[model samples]
Target: MDILLSAIFSSEEEEQYVLDCMAYLMLLMAAWTFFCLLSTNVPYGRYAMYGHGFPVNAKFAWCVQELPAFLVPVGLLVWTSAAKTSLLTNQLIIAMYLFHYAQRSLVYPLLIRGGKPTPFMSFALATLFCLYNGFMQIRYLSHYAQYPADWITRPCFITGSALWFLGLLVNLHSDHILRNLRKPGETGYKIPKGGMFEYVSGANFLGEITEWVGFAVASQSVHSAAFAVFTIVILRSRAVGHHKWYLAKFEDYPKTRKALIPFLY
Candidate 1:
C-alpha cells in the first residue's frame, strides 16, 4: 500500500510539473509574440502579406486551424484517467472552453459571408497555437484543477461568468453586423456599424479578448492566465491593425471609433 501510494503521488507531481512548464512557456510565448507583432502585422486576415506561402480558402482554413482546439480537449477527456468530470467546477469550466471552440471551429467558418484567403504561414501558425493552447487548458482543468465546493457561488466566478457571456454576445453580434455589411455580390470593404463597432473598430477582437480574460479570471489558474495574456497580445495588435486599415481605406471612416477599447484605446 505504501509503495502504491508513493507511485500515485509521483505521477501526480509529474503531471503538475509538466503543466507548470507549459504554462510558463506560454507566458514566454506571449512576450515573444508581443515584441514580434510590434513592428510587423499579424500575417493573416485584412493585413495579410502573402509572399511567405500559398493562400488557402478562408473557410477551410478556419475549420482546419480551429478544429484542434475543440477536438483536443474532447480527446483528452476521453483518454485521460483523471477524474475530470467528478468536480462540478471542472465540468463547467471545461464546458465553457469547449462551447467557445465549438462555435468558432464548426459554426463561425460556415457563417462567414466572404472571407479573404489566409496565407499558408498564418494558417499553420494558428493551427499550431490551437493545438498547444487546447492541450494546455484542458489538460490542466481535466487533470490538475481542483476547486472549493462553493467556488461557483464566489464573486470572482460570478463576475467572470457574466463577462464571458457578455463578451460572447458582443462577439456574435459583431460578426453578424460584419457579415451583413456588404450585399451578397459586393466585394469591397464597408464600415462596420452597430453593436460594439460603434465604439471600437475591432469589436469582434475586443469580444474575443474579453472572453479569454474572463476564462482566466474564472479559472484562476496560471495556465488559463497565460492563455489570456497571449490572446490579448495577439488580438490587441489585430484590432489596431484593422483600425489603421479602416482609417486609410476610407476617408469617411468613423473618427470617434477607437481600436480595441471603448471610448479609449
Candidate 2:
C-alpha cells in the first residue's frame, strides 16, 4: 500500500498533504468520539452486547484488530520510497510505537483467559483505527520528520522516553493484575488491586495515555500529538465508565479511587 501510494503521488509535498489531512481526520474523530462516549460506553469488554454487532471471539478480535498497527508501519518502512527510515530519531520513535502494538496484537491476546466476545462493530472500528493511525504515524516519521544528530541526547527525548517506559511498565503490570483477577474456571468481575489499580479504575488506560503523551513530547509533531489526544479522549471515557460501573455493582468498592487520573480526577 505504501508502495502504491508512493507511485500515485507525483510529489513528496502531495503525499505529506494527504498525511496532514489524515491527521486532521483523527482530531475530528477524537472530538466526535468524546461526545458520543459521554452518553454511552463503547460496546466491548464488560460492556459488550450482542445488539452492538455480531460477536467475535475476543482473542481473535484483538489480534486481528491490532495486527495492522504493527504491520502497516513496518511496511511503510520497508516499501515506501519516501521514508527516511535510516534516521535514528525516526527509528527510535517508530520502534516505540511498534513495541506497544506488538504486545497488544501478539502478546496480550495469547494471554487472555476466557475474555468475552467482542462486538463486530467495535472490532471493525478498532481495526480501522490501527490501520489509519499506524500508517499516518510511520509515514510522517520515516518521510517527513527531521531532527538534529544529537536528538537522542536532548532533554525532551530523554524525559519522554523515560515516561514512555514507565507507562509501558504500568500498563503491563495493570494488565497482568486484571488477567489474574479471576482464578481458572472462575467467572464474574473482581476489583483489581495492586499497582495503579489501587488508585484508578482505568490503570491500563492511564498507562496508554501516558505513553502516547510521552511519545508526542519526544516526537514533537502534530501527528503524534493528535494520536495522544485521541487516546486520551477515548481512554478517559472508558476509564470513567469502568469507575462508574464498579461503584454501582459493588457494595464495598473503593470510594476514593478515581477514574483515569489519580487524586485530582
Candidate 3:
C-alpha cells in the first residue's frame, strides 16, 4: 500500500496530493460547520440530547469512537511508513496529540459513572472525525512535514506547547466538574463550576479550541491550521448554544459570564 504508492509517486508528488486531500477535507468540514451554525443545532449531548436513532452506551461510544484518534497514529508508525524522515519536533507534536486522545479514549470513558445514551448517528459522526483527523495529523507530521532540527527549541514551539498543556488541564478540570455534577442515581442538569467555568459557559470547549490553536502555532502547517479553524468555529457556536440553554433553563444563571470568554463573547 504505502510502499507501492511510494514507489509509484515521487516524494514531492505524493506530498502535494496528500496535502490537497487534507485541504479539501478541511474545506468540507468548514462548510458543514458553517451550515451547522446557521441552520441546525449540534446533534449530541444536551443540545439535541435525545433523538431518533439506535442508542449506544455512552461510555462504549466514547471509548470506541475516540479510540481511532489514539490508535491510528500508532498504526501509522507500525503499519505504514515510520516517519519519512525522523525529527524530534514532529514526534513531539504527534505525542501531544496522542497524549490527549489516550486520556480521552481510555481514561475518560472508564471514569464515566453514568451518562445519557448516545445516538448511533452521533457516535458515527464522531468516529468519522477521529479517523479523518487522526490520519491527517499523523500522516502530515510523520511523513510530509519538514520541521527543522532545532524547531523544538524555537519560541513558537515553546509557547504553543505551554498553551496546549494549559488548555489540556483546563479541559480535564472542566470535564471533571461536569461529570461530578450529578450524584449516584441522579440524572439531572447542574451548572458546571470551578476552573474556567467562572468565566465561560463552555470552559471545556474553550480549552479544546485553545489546544487546537496552539497546535496550529506549533506545527505551522495547513493541516493543523485547518483543524484549529474548524474547531474554533464549531465550538464557539456550541458555546453560544450552551450559554443560551443555561440562561433559559435557570433564571439565576450568571448574566455576567460570556459564552466562551470572560468579558467578551
Query: Judged by lDDT, which candidate is best?
Result: 2
Better of 1 and 2 by lDDT: 2
* Deviation in Å, model 2, residue 209 alpha carbon: 0.6
Assess each prediction's global lDDT (C-alpha) against the native: 0.89, 0.91, 0.84
Using TM-score as the measure, name the better of candidate 1 and candidate 2: 2
Residue 54 of model 3 has an lDDT of 79
Task: Write down the TM-score of every candidate.
Answer: 0.95, 0.97, 0.92
Task: Put down candidate 1 lDDT per residue, 140-200, tens digits, no spaces.
Answer: 8987798999999998888888888888889899999999999877888899999899999
lDDT of 3 at 116: 74
Q: lDDT tens string, model 3, 12-83?
A: 567668765886788688877887687556676775445657788989999999999989877877787665
RMSD of each: 3.4, 1.2, 2.1
Expressed as tens digits, the lDDT of each residue in 116-226 for candidate 2 is 999999999999999999999988998899999999999999998988998999999999999999988889999999999989999999999999999998999889989
- Candidate 2 has which clashing residue pairs, if any? 84-142
